[model samples]
Target: MDDLPIIELPEPYRIDEAQLTDQAALPQLMEQRMDAALQQIEQKASLRTDRHIQIMRENMHKYVEDRFQEAIRGSDDNALALVRGELKIRRADHHDSIARSEARVVELVRGILNQYDSATRVRQE
Candidate 1:
């Protein structure tokens, strides 16, 4: 490190008369920069808020749709149950009617047999 040649240093920085007068405008420049920074921050915050609101709206819409679908499914289930019950009742009624018809046929056959037996006995006598 000591073998390196020495480098000449440049003169120190000095503010000239014109530059010193420009210092009077420093407060205005600072204020403008602060306002611009605040505006950018507010714009970013507004964008985030808008995105959050949109996400919430979408979730709410999906929730409502899901509930609607559930309600429709429940209604369909109830309707199916009602139809099944009605079919069961109708089947029972049909069975009862068939049983009554069979009983009547048996009674009619017995009555016919009785008439035939009585006629035969009278004819023999």
Candidate 2:
């Protein structure tokens, strides 16, 4: 570090003798410097804020679309399962109806046969 060249630094600052005599000179200079420094800080903060807002805006549509797709995909299997369950119930009901119809036909045939037997006994007597 000692090998570094001896750099002649510039003078800090100087104001005209007439301006320095004014009581407001010191406060005005400080205010001007502070304003410049604050402007630089504000510019940097604005740039960062704008970038974040832009990124969020760009992704907003995609985010909403992804959520909708997930909801549909998540419910797809369940909807299919519900339809299948209803179909099974309908099929069972149809089979049960056919069985009841068959049983009624069998009962009617038995009653008719009994009536014929009674008629045959009367003819024989």
Candidate 3:
């Protein structure tokens, strides 16, 4: 209550002394004031509640988006690892194929050279 600002009443305000002494009407007047205060409080409470709900919804959306991005990153990493493994296997297979081809070529060349030497010797004899 100390934090509340003091409001100054406007000029031209006159109090009717008879209204203040009317004991019979005091209860009704008090009830009307209480009802108005309650209505104002309810309006403020409703506004605050709506604001809190909006904030919660926004937070939930952000959290879900963050989780989804994390999942995508995990999936991407797994896929990259799998591709690298497959590439390594294919490279090893290619190297083995090249080695086998080279061996076959060497064997064929040796056979051709031997046949040529035997033919030359027969001609000389």
Q: What TM-score would every model get versus the actual structure?
A: 0.69, 0.48, 0.70
Evaluate candidate 1 by giving its C-alpha RMSD to the native, one decimal. 10.6
Better of 2 and 3 by lDDT: 3
List candidate 2 segments past 4 Å from native: 1-51, 120-125
Which of the predicted structures, 1 or 2, would earn the higher lDDT when compared with the native?
1
Per-residue accuracy of model 1 over 33-108 as CA lDDT, tens digit each: 9999999999999999999999999999999999999999999999999999999999999999999999999999
Better of 1 and 3 by TM-score: 3
Residue 29's lDDT within candidate 3 is: 89
Clashes in model 3: which pairs? none
Deviation from native of the Cα of residue 87 in model 2, angstroms: 2.2
lDDT of 3 at 69: 99
For candidate 3, give the lDDT. Answer: 0.92
Query: Compared with the true structure, what per-residue lDDT tens digits does model 2 show for residues 12-120?
Result: 5555576657756788888999999999999999999999999998799789899999989879978988989999999999999989999999999998999999999
In candidate 1, how many Å is residue 44 off? 1.2
Least well predicted 10-residue stretch by lDDT in candidate 3: 11-20
Error of 2 at 39 (Å): 6.8
Once fitted onto the true fold, the runs of candidate 3 whose alpha carbons sit more than 4 angstroms away are 1-25
Q: Is candidate 2 or candidate 3 better by TM-score?
A: 3
Rank by TM-score, descending? 3, 1, 2
